[model samples]
Target: MIEDMLRTPAAVQDAERHTAHNYHPLPVVISSAEGAWVTDVDGRRYLDCLAGYSALNFGHRHPALIAAAHAQLDKLTLTSRAFIHDQFADFCRALAALCGKELVLPMNTGAEAVETGIKVARKWGYQVKGVPAGQATIVVAEGNFHGRTTTIVSFSTDDDARADFGPYTPGFKIVPYGDLTALAEAVDETTVAVLLEPIQGEQGVVVPPAGYLPGVRQLCTERNVLFIADEIQSGLGRTGATFACELEGVVPDMYLLGKALGGGIVPVSAVAADADVLGVLRPGQHGSTFGGNPLACAVATEVVRLLATGEFQRRSTELGERLHAGLHALIGKGLVAVRGRGLWAGLDIDPALMSGREACERLMERGVLAKDTHGSTIRLAPPLTITAEEIDHAVAQLAAVLAG
Candidate 1:
C-alpha cells in the first residue's frame, strides 16, 4: 500500500515538472487502457468516461485500427504531398463516400481541418461569389470551441482562450448560439460562410434548440453563404448519427472531421465537400506535408470501414437512450439539468451540493472518470463500446458522490 501510494504522487510530480501548466488533470496516473477502462500506476482500474474528449470514440486501441497501424509501420509511412502514396486514394475515397461528399482534403489535426475550411470558404467567396478582397467574413456562434490556432482563438468567446492572443485576426462576426434571428442578422454581403457546431461538444455538449440547425442551413442557403460544420468533436458516431447535422436532417456545404477518424491511434482529420466548393484550390494553393500519408491513410481507411458497418452508431443510439434515462432520473436528487444526444452528455450538478471539480474527484475515487466544464457542469462521453451495466454503475457512483 505504501509503495503504491508513493508511486502515483511521484509519477504525477515528475509529469508536472516537465510539462507546461496548460492542463490540470486528475491525480490518477494511468499506465494503460482498453475499451472503456484504464489501469492506473497502482493497478487500480477506472471507467473511462471522457474517452479522450471524444478522440477515443472507438475506445482505446481498437483491434482493426491497431492492426492497420501495425501493418503500415512495416510498409511505407509518409510521402508528403509531393508524391501520391498508394494508401491515399482508398482512404480518401472511403471517407468521402462516408460523408457523401465528392472530395476529401486530409490533415493531421482538427484545427488544421477548420483552418482549411476557412481558407476554402474565403477563396470561394472571392472567386465564385465575387466578394471584395479583404472583406470576406464568416459568422460564428458564441460559446463555440473550434480550436486554439491564433486565427481560431481570435474569435473565441472564452476569455481564457482569447485573452492575450492578439493582434487577433479579424473578419469574424459572433452571434448568440441557437438563435436563428441573431445568426441571420450577422450575415451580410461580405459574409462568405457560417461556421458552427451542430452540437457544441466543448460547451458542455450543449445541443442547440430543435430546428435550430436546419434553420441555419436555410439561412445560409438563402444568403448564398457556405455552411461549415465543425464536427471534429461531435461526429464519427459520437452522437449516434454519422454527423450531428444528420440528427436534424440538415447537411452543411463542408464537414470538418477529426478525433474519431484516427480511431484513437494517430492524428487524422479531413475536410469533406462537393467538387465545386473544394475544387476552387489550384495546385500549390493549399497542402500539408504529413497530410494523407500512407500510415495515417491505412489506419483511417480501417476506421472508415469500421463506421461503414454501422455497429458503433447503433450502439450509441441504443445505449444513449438508456444513459439519458438514468441521468434524467437524477435531476431532482442532485443534477440540475442534463443535455446531450446519443452517448454524449453534459450534466449540471446542483451547485449547492458541490462544484463539478469536486464531483469529478469524488467520482475518480469511486472508479469512474469524468470531466468538468463550466464550473458546475460535467460532461460524460463514454465509448460506444460501454455496456448497459457499466452505465448504471457510473450513474450509481454519481448518486453516491452527490449523497455524500
Candidate 2:
C-alpha cells in the first residue's frame, strides 16, 4: 500500500506528454470527485480546497447542474449566435435579473467576457461619450489578472503573464490599486473605463480598503467613465456577497462575470450592463460562436436559480467566519498573515519555513489540496457546499503542516 501511494500513475505521466507545458500541477492525478473531496488514481482521497480556482464553487457534478446539462444534451446543444436556441432567453433574463442589469452578452470564458467589456466600453466611448475613434483608453489597476489574451496582457503588470507576449496592445493606463487619488489622476478625457477586480483573487485574494470601491464608482460617475468590475473570480458568492462590490454598497456600470457561472459543468461567461452602455454594439460588431449555447445557458440558468435562493451566499458568510477564525489562530506560529472574505482566504506562510509550492505539496500529502500564487502566498477557496466539520479538518491539516 505504501509503495502504491508513492508510485506516479501512468495517467499522470501521459497527461503532460502531449499538452502544453503551461501548468505545473500537483502530483496527484484525480480520477473522481464528489462535493469537497476528490479521489486520485491511487485511491487516495484529498479534500479539494482550490475548487478549480473557484469554477467548482457549486462543487463537482452538482445534481442540479448535471441534470440541466443532461436535459439540454438530449434536446439541443450549440445553435451559435446565428440562430437563437430555446434556452437563450431564459438564461439571459435570469442572469440579467441577478445582475440587476438590462442586458447581457454571453461568452464562453472569462477572457471573452473581459474582452467583450473592453470592446463595449471602447465603442461606448467612441459613439456615446464622443471620444476619438482610435484614442479611447481604459484604466486598469496594477497586479490585476484579467486574462492571457494578447490584448488583455498588453496592460498586465505581471512579468510572467506579460513577458515576450508583446508588441502589446495599447490605450490602457495603469494606476496603483486601492488608491483613489492615483485612480482619479489616471483617468482623463481619453479614458472610457476603469477595469478592476473588487477582490484580486490571483494576487493572493487581495481586498482593497473599505471605501475604495465606492470611491471608484463615484469617480467614474463624475468623469463619465464606465466602471467595469472584473468579478470573474471574486463574484458568485465566493466573497460572502452576491458581488464583492455589494459589500461596500458600490455598483459598477458593468460586470464581467464568469468562473462559477457554468456551475462546474461547462464554460459560461457574460458581460452585464444596462442597455445604454451595452447598446453601442451593432449585431455584426462582436459576438462568439459558442456564446450562450443551449447547454451552457441551461446549466448557467440553474446556477442563477441556485444563487437566487441566497443559500450559497449565506453558507459562505457563516462558514467563512469559521474558516478565517481557524486560520487567524495559526498566525505567528508559521503563518505571517491571512487575507480574504467568505470561504476564500490567502495565507502568507513564513518564507523562512518553506516556499508556497513546498507548503502545498506538504498539504497534499496530508490530504488537503490547495494552490499557491506568488512567492510565499497560497490561496484557499473551498466549495461553498463544504461544512463546518470539513472546514475544521482542512484548518487542522494546515496547522499540522505548519507545526512540522
Candidate 3:
C-alpha cells in the first residue's frame, strides 16, 4: 500500500498531465507484462482480461513475433511504398491465402484498412458494378466500433463517438445489426458494399443471430454488393476460428484486419479482397508511406504463420467453452447476462448491484483487469495463450467480486 501510494500516484499523475484525456483507463499503471499477466509499477501483478482489446491475442511479446521483429530490425525496418521491400510480398501472400482472397492491400492501422476498403468498394462500384458516378452507397450496421476517423465516424450511431465531429461524411446507410430485413431494406442499386463486424466487440461482444451473417452474405452476393467484415478484434483466432465470419460459414468479399495482425508489437492492418475488387486501385490513387514497412510485414508474416498452425484457434475453442460455462453459471448471481464467443466475453452486471465500471474497478483491486463498454456491460478478451487454470482463476475473481 505504501509503495502504491508513494510511487504510483506520481507516475499516474505525470501520465495524465502529459497525455490527451481521450481515454478513461483504469488507475493501475502497468510497467511490464508476460503471457496473461501484467505487473503494475507498484509491483502488483494482475491477470489481464482485456488483452489490449484483443490486440494482444498472442499475449505480450510472443517469442516468435519478438524474434521476427528483432531479426528484421537488424536487417531492415522501413521502406516506404516508393520502393519494393523483401518482407512485403510474403506478408501479403500469407495473409491473402489466410483470408482466401486473391489480393491484399496493406495499411498502417485498422482505420486505414477500412478507408482503403471504402475507396476500393466505391471505385469498384463505378467501374465494374456500373453504378452512377458519385452515387456509391455503403450499408453499415449500427453499434459498430470501427476506428474513429472522420469518415468512419460519419456513419457511427454512437453519440459519444459521433457528436460534435461534424460536418459528417455521407454515402452510408445505417441498419440495425443482426436484422437481415433491415439490412436488405437499406441496400439498393446504388449500394456498393455492406460493412460489418461479424461479432460486434465494442458493443459488449454482441454476437448476432445465428443466420444473420450467412443472410448478409447471400444478400450481398445477390445484390452485386461487396460484403466487408471488419475483423480487427474478432479475427485471428479470437472467436475460436481464424475469422468470426467463418463460425457462421460466411466468407465476405473483403476482410478489414488489424490489431493482432501486428502480433501486438506494431500497428499493422490490411484489406483482403479478390483481384477484381482490390484491383480497382491504381498506382497513385491509394497508398500509405509506411503501410507495408519491412518491420510490420516481418512481424505480421509470423502472425499469419502462427494462425496457420491452428493451435491458438484450438485453444480458443476449448477454453472458450470453459470460459462460457463458468460465466453462464453466474448469470443470476450478479451478472444479468453473458454474451460472446471464444476468448472474448461481455458480462452484464446487475445494475442494481453496481455499474460495469464499478465492477471492473473492484476486479482491478482483486488483481484482475477488465474494461466496461456501456452501462453494466464489461468485456473480457484474454489472450489465447491463457491456460485453463488461469481461466478458472479469472472466473473465481469475478465470483468473489460479485459476492462482495
TM-scores for every candidate against the unseen true structure: 0.98, 0.98, 0.99
Q: Write the per-residue lDDT of candidate 3 for residues 1-404, one digit (tens) a residue.
A: 56556567888899999999787999999999999999988889999999999899999989999999999999999879999999989999999999999999999899899999899999999999999999999999899889899999999989989999999999999999999999999999999999999999989999999999999999999999999999999999999999999999999999999999998899999999999999988899989999999999999999999999999999999999999999999999999999999999999999999999999999999999999988899999999999999999999999999998
lDDT of each: 0.94, 0.95, 0.94
> Roughly what TM-score does model 1 have, to 2 decimal places?
0.98
Off by over 4 Å in 2: 1-7
Query: Which pairs of residues have clashing backbones in candidate 3?
Result: none
The reply for model 3, stretches above 4 Å from the true place, is 1-5
Look at candidate 2 and give me any clashing residue pairs: none
lDDT of 1 by residue, 284-341 (tens): 9999999999999999999899899999999999999999999999999999999999
- Model 3 scores a C-alpha lDDT of 0.94
